[model samples]
Target chain A: MDFELSEEQRLLKDSVDRLIAKEYRFERRLDFLRRSEGWSRQTWQGFAEMGLLALPFAEEHGGFGSGGVETMLVMEAFGRGLVVEPYLSTVILAGGTIRHSGASGRMAETVERIIAGEHLMALAHNEKGGPRHSLEPQTRAKRSGACWTLTGSKIAVLHGATADELVVSATTDTGSALFLVPAEAEGISVSPQKGYDGVPLAEVTLEGVSVQTEFVLCEPGMGEKVLAHVIAEANAALCAEAVGIMGDVFDTTCEYLLTRTQFGVPIGSFQALQHQAADMLIELELSRSMAILAALSIDSEPPVRERNVSAAKAQIGRSGRLIGQRAIQLHGAIGITEEYKVGHSFKRLTAIDAMFGNADWHIDAIVEAGGLYTA
Target chain B: MDLNFSVEDVAFREEVRTFLASSLPDYLCAKMIKRLHLTKDETVHWQRILNARGWATPSWPVDCGGQSWSPSQRYIFQEEMALAHAPETQPFNVNMIGPILAKFGTDEQKAKFLRSTANLDIWWCQGFSEPGAGSDLASLKTSAVRDGNHYLINGQKIWTTQAQNADWMFALVRTDSSGRKQEGISFLLIDMTTHGITVRPIETIDGGHDANEVFFDDVRVPTANLIGEEGKGWTYAKHLLGNERSGIARIGLSKERLKQLRSLEHELSASGQLDERETVGLKRKLAEVEVQLRALELTQLRVVSADAHGANAGAAASILKIKGTELQQRMTELVLELAGPEGLALAVDDHTDGSGGWQNPAAQFYFTMRKVSIFGGSNEIQKNIIAKTMLGL
Candidate 1:
């Protein structure tokens, strides 16, 4: 039907675009990343004030009740800015899980804190060697008296170091369950490190981390379903983000080709390089379409949502690689330098590809789901 | 943005599907489904069938006897036709010169050609590329000097597809030799039966005679045959080439070929002819191509949607061409791969056996598909267009 954004959606896009332009400059982002907190708390508060932090939550939860398209707009803008904040981890991953799992009472209070930028949350679902789509956690959760103790490690907990609470997935006697463990819990330790794209990541060790019964976000056996819901949303967000990064990277590469002269003319005038640039654009456009498809289908039935999310992730992963590599190749030596925005965008795109299942993983998932031939 | 078709669009698709199901000839559908080459008469017969239903030229304007469907409607019609194995309407008349004539032809010219073109009463072929002007078509040396009342044509054109079957040829001739190479050209419509006009068949690698080398030696064309102004052929040719490139993506055809490949794979697996490793590899390759095809389909929808909103989709068309052709070639290759030894059979007439070991024309189809990337301006030229016009490179 219609591909045009509504007037309200256009305004949201313009506001986000303006915000990124004003505050999330490439150099400013680097400065924010270098701080002790690894990101600008002021910018986090800015997102809250701008209503982006509350965009995806229910209006009853003191939020905007915005849909996937709205979240995609903000995520894409964040991607263009290469914003070094934990929005994916804090909001879509952890906050989304809580919302989907029917978090109430204390958990709902935590969601409010997250929306207000007063607290940060990271979903610690990935274990050391679990399958990419598997949410059956290896971490153990045992209830004794009035408390449940978690005892295992979650590797690559996005923004775990800075998060105020960790939405930890653990296997219980009945099945898997989600527990909100405080970052400052007595038996928890976080080894934080800068990821490939200079974003804060941590390997969290939850050694006998005790949590009250109220901290469990959902009933037993609901963890996998909740995690699946959260992952789908995160996948959609990452796909949109990759589209943004690839788009910018493509623009930067095209600009470089037009301006950077070699021999007697702009290097872009050369047919060989021009063809490569065209391939990059093709990849970017395809990725964009896929991202839109994923975003639009994020809230569908589980099977349909998973299929679309996997399709988007697979396409984005494949196209992102081509666009990123071709972009660097077109930019020549300058593309690989840290000083250039193109390279930084390439780095972020690469990270997004590896996150939430890469192309090969998603393609395999699709093949396993009746092999794409039937569809 | 919503990707689902509207209820009306869905109803239109159903209407088309029902029409195709009941109307398409079984013999023609059999040829199409098997990728067998259809004869010129067969193609014209199918066109007549569509003409009888008043759906022959979906893309043309209503005033010119076209259905004047929306872009989405046209796309759905095309997709449904391909899926139903309906023969393609010859592009020369329907897609190429017809649109140019509709836009620029004089009232007299339109009166003479528009109805006949839509009814397939006249078969047309393009005469733009010369021996030395394939991608660089502006440098063509096909000259048509002015005589008393007609242009004295004396030049040659190469890779003129379907010329053997054409009753007329819409050509580009060098009307001026002093100005820029692109400025001196003139668009002329030449009768194929004109004296001194030679249509020599050029056998392609696929062992087919679909193209030719058309030589013009003192061929006379009435002044009335010229579509537009002299020395403006390059402009008209560019417009025609844009139309040419737009449909050359062949998304519907690729979807059909992909579906055929899957069926072949299933057939091979059911008979235990494909090993487990080969089956897995085939599935993986099919999955990859399927994903790319789906993306291309969505990209096409975006372009169509953008066009409906009055936005320029020039570069998006180029993108579709590049990906569409590549996917086409890839699917054909997979078809051949699925065919195994049967694909290697050369000079095989039909893909049928009494024992149900259907012999696919995959090898010939694959060989023919190579031209998809090369013709209608090579994929390389499409990239050049994208770089220059879209990226400003």
Candidate 2:
């Protein structure tokens, strides 16, 4: 089996890499992050123009029709550049879920807008006390003829503070279902929350928030499939992002060690310090492989998808924490300072880790599906 | 871009599996599967068998008794061997010195050493490391004073793995003390049976005697034994190190360990009432490690595959060593954890006969892997290499 990217894939990666080098400079992102929003709208539009925001959805939905591996490559580049767009929340999780659930017409129109960078959607799914991807929803949806009123709050609505609309999960009389509710709907309130990576998130309160029957994003009883797809894609993207962040983490740590000196020589010259950096490199590389595998498994049928995603999340979660913690530890006291980019990168890695499921969470998921041997 | 193996490679893998099953002695395989150190005779016995079949040096050039397999085929063979618990051919001979002589040794050196080296007639130990010169190997103080037609060697070498059983050692000695540390050094091949030579086994923390401290008190060696030109030894030694780093990741062995960890977790987590959730959680973590191990193996395949096709100096090997060792330590820790109170067993001797079951070897194995990240050029060095070489750090 070959592991090298195809020539076309390599060219695409090069193009993306060159584009990020020109446009998404770290200084620009740092400036944007320190602002109230913690993200740049222009950069978001640029990504849309690049066709990145549409890479995962179907062609019919105005996307590039690229699968998970391509998505992984782009997200990894995004992670390495520390791109602070709502690609994960708006494009991947929420928009991907709607596309996967076969939502069309106006919903399809919104998806197309997202593809064109005109509008964005955030997924408001997780509630307090609920583990990631948990199907048992605490929020309720009451059916009133052609209208449905959503009650209860959704915490951790990724990019919720910025999205024009939200695809939320709630329990109905039948089962769990996905609803497209307007972000500015009456009785709906959103308070911006700070993600560890300085990205904007929100704790959304849907007090009797209402949606029309046509706004349902998933087949009434098939929310399970939509939720599964969203969680899988979300975790896969997070894994790719961690792989990217660790790439940055390894570079930052290596540069520090090379320049930082102790006992009259660069610390990089010391075997003790050098060996630690090498260990980080190992984790980063292996994590990249797992991330690719998870991204590849995104469209696979159950069992394989569960196993691959679980494995990727678990491995990336473990390595992400190690790389993040060691990146700081090796960088010494300066690493923890807000002034250092390594610290910020470490925070982002930690957040990606705790997002979908921690190492332990995914590990359990793998076993619950079947042993790796069986899978 | 295809991820599926060619039919020939697949068939080659099956051939390796069959050969390992029928050819390797059951006892030797058992030792490997359990990560037990092979007895001297057991190692030699297996190597001879492999030599006879011309599979002893799977990656060596065919004219020198190497297998005629492609790069992917050789990788598959190595992976299958490791997974089947077949004893790894002694690295000092196959991986380190043999390749050095083949690539850089003089024609005379090749005629004298190649065949016996491949056939296991001469057991070799590396002498690059010294007490004060582990990572900064160029700083070594071991000197070889030139005389008429011979050189008198002086000073000591430490951490020489398997020197006690070695017939010869390919050593790095100071030949020109006036020049730069790296430039002044030379590679010397010394017979371990020479006069004024002393070999003392240094027991590592894992209770293995494979490592040693070797001393030379004016040991005399013919100039003919020097590899390449004087002071060019540094260049040859670097070549040797480059070869060493090529396979230091050890993916095949880690894959076997992961499988063992999974089975152990299942056996432990299923019995009686523990916090079922935590038990399940721990098992899941073990599975995750296995998954990562598989990914690492795939990366290894890519690296070794490219290496076969002449893509050397890639940063992927650095990545492999880092993640492979970490995962190894994690697997050991998980096994020990599952062993619970049984993990604290100080009875290292219990596994000597392979009766430790799963519990006995778990502790000692965990302790042994603590050195993995430190030895064979520590993981930290690998990262710096990747940074400079691959990422342009």
The number of the candidate with the highest TM-score is: 1
Instruction: Estimate, for each residue in A50-109, the C-alpha lDDT of model 2 and write its tens digit.
Output: 888888777877777887778778888888888888988887888777878877666667
Task: List, in order, the clash count of every candidate structure.
Answer: 0, 10
TM-score of 2: 0.86
lDDT of 2: 0.81
Candidate 2 chain B: worst-modelled 10 consecutive residues by lDDT: B240-249
Instruction: Name the docking class for model 1.
Output: medium
Provide C-alpha RMSD values for all models, in order: 1.8, 4.0
Model 1 CA deviation exceeding 4 Å by range? A373-375, B243-248, B350-360, B391-393
- Clash pairs, candidate 2, are A274-B380, A274-B381, A275-B379, A275-B380, A275-B381, A276-B380, A278-B379, A278-B380, A278-B383, A363-B284
Cα lDDT of model 2 by residue, B1-393, tens digit = 445688988898898889888998988877777666668788889999988888888667777667777767767777788888888888889988888888777789889998888878889999989999987888999999999999999999998988999999999999998978899999899999999999998987776677899999989999999888899887887665555333556777777777776666566667753468767677657666677777777677667656766776467766777777888898888878877887676665633577666676777788888988988777766667765673344
Q: Cα lDDT of all candidates, in order? A: 0.86, 0.81
Question: DockQ values for all predictions?
Answer: 0.74, 0.38
